[model samples]
Target: MQVTSHFYAQLTIAIIKGVASCLRLFHVLGLIILCSSLSLPLHAIEQSSNTQIKQVHLHDNQGKSINIGQLHVQADGQFTFELRDEVFSDHFLSMKEMKYIEGPELWCHIAYPYPLNRDFNADKAWLSHDLLFMYKKSNQFGAMMWQGVYYKFTKEDGRLIGYANGVDLSEIASAPEQIHTPFYDESYMEPHNAQERWLPTLTID
Candidate 1:
């Protein structure tokens, strides 16, 4: 009986030691997993902080200059220009072709493929050719649509040009409101002298 009792006590100690070993192992694994999870967010934040934003200086046709704060290129090849004063944020621009124009002026031309109206169904909608122009020397910006309406912007003010039927870009308080062409007005057109000079052509080597 004594021997049997001693054997049982030894068995209990062994079982308890085994359970304690397993618990310690599990605790170590849990600590490792927690540490790994914490490091992932830190790494992501570091990467985000390292993202670079490019600066651009541009002038309009009227000799007005704007210092663009940041320029971002999206994955779809669209470019976003952010103005210094936050007058515009994430303004989308697309440049698919670099046409050689002989002039002493610097002009930035953009073609937009996406519809300005998000709710309009593109499949059944009548698409218009949305073209935007920015002059380097004159400090003028304009957009010409296929529907015969346009918007012109200068350093001091902006106006809706062309037919009186479209949306007024000047009245657009938000970026979302500037998307639809039908909302612009054509009666707001003002006469301005067009600059014949252009900046030097961009060369990609």
Candidate 2:
């Protein structure tokens, strides 16, 4: 009888220890799973906060690339490009096939047109267009856009060449009212002249 009682006591203690060990193991696994789930969004946010760079070509109205520019895009969806040389020259624009040879090396900073939403959809087609750029050489308010919003070019120590096509905001029902900003005007775009030249094409190579 005494031996049987001792055996039962030992068996009960062993079962209790086994159950405690399993509970501890399950608690540790739960902590690990919780930590892993919490880190997923953190990893995604880190990747989204990183800036990206791309090589883009600025094409002219004739579908020819004049120069290559580097586009620096921020995580917030804003972007800018650096132009190293003067694009428009009488020799290059007149001839269809010629190596772009002559221009002074200077930095032309192209800024974004407006504040882009963080969730703005980056359309590759928008980047590749026979678009027109409106810029102020001194103020550095450079903006480029396609022929959808009518731009009213205000003559500030600047010139506009009608080489690129224009958009009439009145014709489009979906055109935003912001197109009437002082940066542009309703005046007809004058033809390209020697003094005021249009933005030349850009190539990626």
Candidate 1 segments whose C-alpha is farther than 4 A from its true place: 53-205
Model 2 lDDT, full chain set: 0.41
Model 2 stretches with alpha carbons more than 4 Å out:
51-167, 174-205
- Give the Å shift of residue 32 in candidate 2: 0.7
> Candidate 2 on 51-123: residue-level lDDT in tens?
6655545434455444444555677776555554455332221232222323222122223343333221353
- Residue 90, candidate 1: Cα error in Å is 21
What TM-score does prediction 2 earn? 0.34
Residues 10-105, candidate 1, lDDT per residue (tens digit)? 999999999999999999999999999999999988866644344444344555544434544333434344434543323322332322121353
- By summed lDDT, which 10 consecutive residues of candidate 2 come out lowest? 90-99
Residue 54, candidate 1: C-alpha displacement in angstroms: 7.5
lDDT of each: 0.39, 0.41
